[model samples]
Target: MTRPFPDDDSATLAAHLRRQAEEHRAKYVRAQSDRADKFVTSPRRVYELIRAGIRRGTMPHDQTLSEQHLIESLGATRNAVRKALQMLAEDGVLVRARRAGTSVVHDIVAVHDGEVGPRAWAGTPDEGRLTVDTLEISRISAPAVLQRLLGADTDSVLLLEQLGRMGGQPLYLRVGYCMTDATAEEFSQLIESNHTEFPPISVVHERLFGSAYGGSDYVVEAISCQERAAELLDMPVGAPVLLRELITRNSAGAPSELSYTHFRADRVAIVGSTLATTAASP
Candidate 1:
């Protein structure tokens, strides 16, 4: 709303009046949103909008979510928007608290392209509580890729399967195959003795070999979830998934471990960034 300026020759007075007007307008908006019984939007519709924003990477990833902004943008009642926020929190897409407000869980599994090794992507980058559960650790007959990458003499590789969860919701499943001289039982014993929960793969490598990895290479692709992975991730078979293939090398530049990570495509988004490049001269 616009109002005619007062007959005052002072610009300071005009600024003060504008500040007061803005404060009043904000309060009015909040008051209007508090009337939950009169809005046209339903709670489910508000949730869909929020879900779409998360899936499309349009929501703010680093900032606290604003209840007032959602209510105003969606023309939704306070209760409807509130329920939507709660739903996202339940789904592990957002973290909410009475005093902390709501915020998006931006990257449940995020890492930069240039980071060196499992040291780069092994740790967590999410906002909510995260847990890694060990599913299986066994010896598998070496696949053609592993044999070619590691060496022809590698007859069997150790398989380390894990499930990743955020806020109690399953988000990813990782199947890592390491070309190690140790047997499956020996590796399991080492993992148990090393840390309490499922430790990082690099830690296991260090525990077993007593050396740090040299570096790692990563390749990301889109794929359909197969039966075994779908069952663990709580998604339907044939659903979209993001596959991240990582190959960790020894200090001598020899490939040591090959890992495949599958993330729910709907809950994960990969952003590409270049830090070592510069713009052309003007």
Candidate 2:
């Protein structure tokens, strides 16, 4: 049995790989330096859509919007529709009553993009300051994993990839997937027109599906970067990275989109806030 290389070959190969990764990262960053100004995420589109319905008399005043009706009409999950309703209610566009359900409070209220808080888009206040650049958009057959995750009956999907930055320094790479059917063309057009400034997948779901902007369920893991992920994050292949898989679902617990975001270990840090719980009475 002949050996593939000398005993020290493995160490040599590792060094070469690291060098290659560094070189690739340097080249990518340099090329993207001349990019234009970026923007933050918003769910203005969904808010507008519902507002239009109200003003157009399509959703008349005092009409209740049930969860099932919104899901079917807008293709959004219950949670997203609910959030939109809540935002509308706050703006005096709609109202929620315990026994009466959600009803239109007024005919029209213009809720602009920046008017909403961080909670509207499942992001922290700090994240609203980060710049985003659209990197890639494509249409492809839904992979088995996505099919299972999204519960999509269709075979096709729209994919959007973006890079987040702060002070012109790269931070993270986010990839999003949504099932294709009626919104395929709309998704494609939005990606083409507003890739960098486009809302996050959760907001996109509400806008496209006419659902409220619900948050996502995230699964975090520390994994070695493979070739594609390394290229996206400008990290060396095999370097340790943080992977966050998000499944954005509606109020009924049905998924609307699936996303996998990669963060360079050196460039990103994760922090969160939790509420304090009071002790139960004995």
Candidate 3:
């Protein structure tokens, strides 16, 4: 067989393809980080500027900003602005009424969960302060929903209701349930000591179980606040609120605690992350 000359054009084409792929990957990572930064930082500034514009009559209340308008106003990309607007809406900073587009309403409350310690408050320990007022802990029979979360029979559960605050403002109203025997003694002691502010139940779980507590497998959904919950949160009855229901398990995978939290729409922001999944190879 005759030897064939190597195809120089094919080699060049392969190298070009590799370069293009690298450039595309770099661009994707930069875009993703840029969008995340917008969500983390720029939304607040955007809200401030928009609010100022509205107050100065530069932006009317009835004026609607499409996604493009927001991008232009903030000098951000369309994707970044869209992500910011979604975060704002979830946090109740902006109202997106049906057929009304998006408009600035009130400032959204920033609520940080202390699952990984209290580093969430702008790198200041003081900012992580949880001001406890209006704290009234009362024992009651666990409701059906709470009982299910606790993985216990209704009769075996006791609910502890607490109205919590941060910086003297009511931020979340929570109801926690535990097996009556598991928490009765501590509950009695807490009441006797007149402890107004208790550590998070996760901490309590660790102290009681002698093992560190991991976070719960939980579900978060937005629901209309009940009349009682709404009153405690200072919102109108049936107002929209974020409801988080957590079912905590111990190292043995046994349900240890069930917590139901209703956050004030204006006073709390729930931050979460999404994972990127890769496809399986054939």
lDDT leader: 1
Per-model C-alpha lDDT, please? 0.72, 0.63, 0.62
Task: Write down the RMSD of all candidates, one decimal each.
Answer: 12.7, 26.2, 12.2
User: What TM-score would each prediction reach against the true structure?
Assistant: 0.55, 0.46, 0.52
Report lDDT (Cα) of residue 182, candidate 3.
Answer: 53
Residues 71-90 of candidate 2: C-alpha lDDT, one tens digit per residue: 55765555666677777786
TM-score-wise, the better of 1 and 3 is: 1
Ranking by TM-score: 1, 3, 2
The worst-scoring run of ten residues by lDDT in candidate 1 lies at: 114-123
Model 3 over residues 203-261: C-alpha lDDT tens digits? 55665445566656777789998998888877889888888877776767777667788
Candidate 3 accuracy as TM-score:
0.52
**In model 2, which runs have C-alpha deviations exceeding 4 angstroms?**
1-129, 180-185, 188-204, 274-282
Q: Please give me the total number of clashing residue pairs in predicted model 1.
A: 0
Displacement of the residue 29 alpha carbon in candidate 1, Å: 34
**RMSD of model 2 against the true structure:** 26.2
